[model samples]
Target: MNSGVFITFEGPDGAGKTTILSMVANHFKEAMVTREPGGIDIAEQIRKVILNKENTAMDPRTEALLYAAARRQHLIEKVKPALEEGKMVLCDRFVDSSLAYQGYARDLGIDEVWSINQFAIEMLMPQLTIYFDIEPELGLKRINKNKEREINRLDLENLEFHQKVRDGYYLLMERFPDRIARIDASGTVEEVYEQTVKMIKDKLAK
Candidate 1:
């Protein structure tokens, strides 16, 4: 069986990852493009709860668990099946989001958060993860300028929290440099997309 290649895209909010993914999807027509927190029906419901602006009352651990729950359902229902069929699975976000947003930014300890995810994912990890690196200030500014972008609970967080999320991603980069490819996201959409496509091509060539 041709167990397919799994790739995930990650970055702080408003880094244009979703937009880039949509464009990338156009280029790779055969690839299955999806996003975490919401890929399948069950997970989409969880995504609504986790991202609702009214969910400001949610505790850190609760948020983490919710994301994990969504990830589990999405993985079982979508990701694994695509990979088993030898398709290129391109996900917008994965465990890295939890590790950054909840684990590091929320001060829940990466190892601790990882322990729970270990159960949820059962060690299923993407072969490649593209991380769009950006400054929190610029990212948040982009969010504010984009009126159409969903204003979620995480988007409302203070700059400090977002910075922590970026820092957390940096730590992860250090931890898994080989699997996680970092791309500067401060440029225009075309530039970022070009860099991303090059990275993907390089990985595919390997």
Candidate 2:
């Protein structure tokens, strides 16, 4: 039995997940908000390499490994400690991002990527995961409109690849229906945030 609750927010780029997560974090005074690959010093260094646009030659498997490595370090340095202290840990992304982006979208085989991540996380899974569902085209449009947000390496991926990432999220949702909740992210930010809060509150009520 885990001592603290782990909740993850997952979505394709431009899905407004980060925006909503920030709002939700503020609402939950006891919650600790963090993101993958850069939540801690070691992980932040790994994140820089992974998101470097110049590293186009990086292999799909290599990208997956780097993400897992960063994830492991973040979990050790930040997430687990917060959880141990009985704080509600709200992470922006977790293993699902790897499964969707690298495993399915990159043609790395979901099962194969999952096996490696299993080793990284040591069976530590989120108690709840909220997936923001949106069309890939619309998501990209949102990203393009948001000039303030940094355009990362993943943002440069083509539309077809992003579509596959969305599909991968859906597949994972089917696999973990009890843990993953879908929220339509096409609406206004306030609308989406309300839905997110409701989900989190409902989960906590249980």
Candidate 3:
């Protein structure tokens, strides 16, 4: 049987990861697509509790642990099973988001957040990570244009926080150069999708 492949898409807001992931999922017949704090029933419930707008007073550690809990459940119930059966899993976000959003941006420290995630994921790292490159200012601009969307609390963080997230991602890239690929996302949807599709095909061919 072919070894299962785990690929993740990650970036700051407005990098069009959703759009690109959707397109790639449709094209890949064997792909099991999912997003963080979701993908399974239990995880989805956790996602609702954590993401609810009313929980403005939620503690940072509480939030970080919740994200990890959701991830653990999702990986156990959905991701690992698919991988065992040799299915390609295309995750929209993974542990990196935690290291960036909660660890770095929330001032939790990457090491602390990663320690928790280590327990959650047990080192089930993605085989490939596609990092969408977009400037912080442009990303926030995209959020501004989408007024209908109920913004998450993380979105309310200041530019400094977002910049820290970006820097964290860069640090992650440095740490995993062979596994991560940076793609310029500030292009036409067609352009970005085409490049991403080609990369996935190339990797699968290997």
Alpha-carbon local distance difference test for all models: 0.94, 0.95, 0.89
- How would you encode candidate 1's per-residue C-alpha lDDT over 1-206 as one tens digit per residue? 43999999999998999999999999999999999889999999999999999878899999999999999999888999999999999999999999999999999999989988999998999989999989999999999999998899999999999999999999999999999999999999999999998999999999
- Alpha-carbon RMSD to native, per candidate: 0.9, 0.7, 1.6
Worst 10 residues of 2 by lDDT: 1-10
Encode model 2's per-residue lDDT on 152-193: one tens digit a residue: 899999999999999999999999999999999999999999
User: What is the model-wide C-alpha lDDT for candidate 2?
Assistant: 0.95
- The C-alpha TM-scores of every prediction are 0.98, 0.98, 0.94
Candidate 3: tens digits of C-alpha lDDT, residues 1-206: 23689999999977888889999998996799999879899899988888887888999999999999999999988888899899999998999999888988888999999999999999999888999988888888888898775587677778887888888899888988999899999999899999999998888888
Better of 2 and 3 by TM-score: 2
Q: Report the C-alpha displacement of residue 26, candidate 3, in angstroms.
A: 1.4
Candidates ranked by TM-score, best first? 2, 1, 3
The per-residue C-alpha lDDT of model 3 at residue 27 equals 90
- Worst lDDT 10-window in candidate 3: 148-157
